[model samples]
Target: MKVLITGAAGFIGHALIKQLSATAEHVVGIDNINDYYDVELKHARLRDLEGIGNFTFIRADLVDAEVLNQIFATHRFDCVINLAAQAGVRYSLDNPKAYVQSNVVGFLNILEACRNFAVPKLLYASSSSVYGLSKDVPFSTRQSVDCPISLYAATKKANELMAHTYSHLYGIQTIGLRFFTVYGPWGRPDMAMFKFTKAILEGKPIDVYNHGQLSRDFTYIDDIISGVMRLLEKDGLEANSVFNIGHGSPVSLMDFIRAVESATGMTANCNYLPMQPGDVEQTWADTQGLFDAVGYTPSVKVAEGAARFVEWYRAYYKI
Candidate 1:
């Protein structure tokens, strides 16, 4: 199968390219390589795929409709895994237009291109943050996600809706994977795991959000890639479906910090603080839909995942 992956320089995107390129799939990846975090890290992710098989990298943005159409016209893709978007929940509070341009407008472009190109499968990235402020223990797709606290979450929910519209109108097979806090090696720097690891090693204080009371279903990156690959290969799923991809178990913020400490062999200087706006108290993903569909079971525990991430960080930075 020929697959086109947006945000190819991103955390999960890079991992997916690595995984799929190892198989029989021909992979094409594109990224705007924005300065949302560190562009160097994004470049580093691309550098990791230098000698991979049948993997082509294109530096581009999803917001550009003309370029997208040209690419689609040039290469007929069997499937498109749309991961390009203005990520970061808190960042959305400051620059909501980024979400609008990248998430909403950009996603529309993807849907249109897929429809025009007759692409069969369209899998996209959603977020557990869509279940904002809900008191639900484990966030499920069956539950209503009409309420989203941040613009980022709203855009993600909108992506799900947009994909559904495309599916209903054009008969495209669309699946939205609402990912929880995904953490592992080659993870995003803005995420908790990376930030905590960096700060701990630098002997700097880490901000314990919600006074260390918040919890998250920290799914490992390998588990995430596995679930995605399984879904990509399977058939018989509804034309438009959504699934939660995460570790079923939730870990407290403090516990996560301790795991990083154990991994780095250094104690963190903790600074407890109130929860920031657009932040949820806790998030737990009910991946039963994924498991029932593809036997997608998360294998890595938080402690082990944290340790692996720390090891990668040390090696990457020579710290």
Candidate 2:
């Protein structure tokens, strides 16, 4: 089957594409390769995908509806997995415009193309930040995500609303996956896991935001890929569904740091500080709905995941 995987050079996107390649499916990948992190890292991901047959890479912004529709016209994609977006909650503070352009306008174009082309399942990335300082533990899809702390989160929440509109109007099946703190090899540099690992390995101090009190549902890349693959192939899912795709177990910031330290066998000098703006204190995913629907259960522990990431990071960075 031919599939259009947007953000195909990204962290989770790269992992998903590798899985797709194994099946010998025709996959058309798109990415703007913005300098949100290192462009080199994005290219490296594309290079890896290039080695596989039946994969096409297109570097373009999603806001270009003409280009987006053009791709839709050229390829009859069985499904379109939209993963591209302006990421990072804190970075949204400085570049709110980026969030609007990529997350809102770009998403509108995607919904429009899906409406016109009638792609089957549209799986887009959503964020836990939509909960917005909510004290509720294990955030569920049933609860309203009306408040968003960052512009990034607001755009993601907006995407869910937009998808619902199209799903209702055009009879398109769209699934929004509210991903937690996803991290592993080839992960974004802005994420805490990548930053901490890099800093600790270089004998530098890593920032402990909120005095190391923050907790996150740290999911491994492999577990996430498994969930996505199953979700993609599994038919007869409810239309206009939103699922929390994450490792249910949340890890404290300190505990996470300790795991990273263990992974690299290096003690980190932490620069403990107050939390930054647009930062959430904790995030836990209530994935029972997803589990019931698709038998989704994350099996990777944080320690093992961290160690695996360190191994990949060391080999990739030659450090």
Report lDDT per candidate. Answer: 0.94, 0.90
Q: How high a TM-score does candidate 1 get?
A: 0.99
Worst 10 residues of 1 by lDDT: 18-27
Regions of model 2 farther than 4 Å from truth:
none
For candidate 2, what is the lDDT? Answer: 0.90
Best by TM-score: 1
- The positional error of residue 243 in candidate 1, measured at the CA in angstroms, is 0.2
Question: Model 2 over residues 213-292: C-alpha lDDT tens digits?
Answer: 89999988888888888888889997899989889989999999999999999999999999899898999999898899
Model 1 residue 36 distance off true place after TM-score fit, in angstroms: 0.4
Tens-place lDDT digits, model 1, residues 90-169: 99999999999999999999999999999999999999989999997788899999999999999999999999999999
Against the true structure, what is each candidate's TM-score? 0.99, 0.98
